[model samples]
Target chain A: MAQKTYAGVTVELTDEGYLVDKNQWNKEMAVEIAQENDITLTAKHFAVIEFLRDKVEKGETLTIRAIGKSGIVDIKGFYELFPGAPLKVATKISGLSKPVSCV
Target chain B: MTEKEEYPLKKVCIICAKGNLEDVYAACVMANGAVMEGIETKVFFTFFGLDAITKKQMNHLHTATVGNPAMRMPNGWAFPSVLGMLPGVEAGVSSIMKKQMEALDIPTIPEFLEMITAGGGELYACKLATDMFKLKKEDLSDEVKDIITVGEFYGLCGGQGTQIIFT
Candidate 1:
């Protein structure tokens, strides 16, 4: 892990750029991280990010199916939001660990 | 001196030839995994595997309890193959397997296909198998892009960093 600044707040991040401490996250830092992934945070993107952060906080496993059923967005929109690797990209921007689930 | 360069996986093509629930899921899990990684993925279901794409049968597949040497009881005792012939045993085993998969968030066969396609992956059925089974286009799940010959399947598989897997 390494220290980096996002939106003027310096935080710890993994080599892959995921946050080391989710508690250090904030909306402004998330905006910078999302920009790194070429995403411009919109209301819809924030919806999915908040959903993911909430699930992680509750110690629930993340799955594409769960997000699709989250009512915030369907699976397709989720992919469009994070394109390529939805769960991995979304979690990284949301200041969570890289997802390890195969599903 | 030259430096070695890495070639990340670019595409994956998977084929499921058996209808067993385990075999079908193996193919799907691999294909979906690739899709989730943003790699191009294509899956072909043939022969008994056609059941995986069969609209009515996709969600109700069963594994082979009789011939599978690895079959075991929940308590880890060796399962007697002869008992596999008993009424309701296979169905019971299959349901248990499905439940275990659900706990891991593995999607149903239909849902797996949906997830794959939703990520821009492709699914196909084998032409010969569909003909032998007397199945029409509508008989397969809508997620299937087409019923294609093995030759046609090969046509879609050649490229750098592409792998073809058979189950």
Candidate 2:
């Protein structure tokens, strides 16, 4: 697993996808991740992250395509390859009935 | 060195008239540099200059072909007014110029206005010119601080440290 530390959060790229520590997901974390990944985090990216985090909280398996279209990832093709495993889209990973745009 | 010795000119006001893309971009680049230099800046848009500030028309600003001295076309060729009349030609030229400027990190006029305002500069519309052109406040971008008469502009330009420049 290749890993990087961003703003004290451990982000590891696994065979499954990106694994972000639950204790370290926030606006600062998002900015750090974007910066580390060389992606420009625009206002639209923030909107999508909030939306995806809500979905993760509700226990829905977020489609990689959906995540890409949501505007968070500047490179969608890489994310599109991982469609199976319950990808950890949010830091506070929990099981729920559905996905909400935010907490 | 003391603050006074480190920096001198306090304010600069620029007047822009409608012209070719190079001229318009040159005007914007000058204003941006002045703002970066910590000088208070004002850009007053009048007549065809309004195209550089209006939202819908801003992206299509072009360089003057007939009498402009700084214009150069592809392969050392000069662009003729007849070719400029073709549909989308002006926009193509504008886009090319914008790409070149972006490569050089010079902000577009709208972006330049945002930079200026963020840096404590002011942007205004020429009231008389606006009325004569039948343009309303809504015709301009939301960043414009206000519309003022030429006399009012002069009032803002007053003081020994202020320099007014026409582009």
- Top candidate when judged by DockQ against the true structure: 1
Q: For this target, which candidate reaches the highest lDDT against the unseen true structure?
A: 1
Interface RMSD of 2: 19.8
What are the lDDT scores of the predictions, listed in order?
Answer: 0.93, 0.61
> iRMS of candidate 1, one decimal?
0.7
TM-score of each: 0.97, 0.56
What are the RMSD figures for all models against the true structure? 1.4, 14.0
True contacts kept of 2: 0.00
Q: Which digits, one per residue and each the tens of the lDDT, describe model 2 over residues B15-71?
A: 987645665676676675565455678888887887777888776677655454445
List where candidate 1 sits over 4 angstroms from the true fold: B1-4
- Give a tens-digit lDDT track for model 1, residues B1-167: 99999999999999999999999999999999999899999999999999999988998999888988999999999899999989889999999999998888889999999999999999999999999999989999999999999999999999999999998
User: Considering only N, C-alpha and C atoms within 3 Å, which residue pairs clash in candidate 2?
Assistant: A55-A99, A58-A96, A59-A96, B20-B62, B20-B63, B20-B64, B21-B62, B21-B63
DockQ category of candidate 2: incorrect
Q: A7-56, model 1: which lDDT tens digit per residue?
A: 89999889998899999999999899998989999999999989999999
Q: Score the docking of each candidate (DockQ).
A: 0.81, 0.02
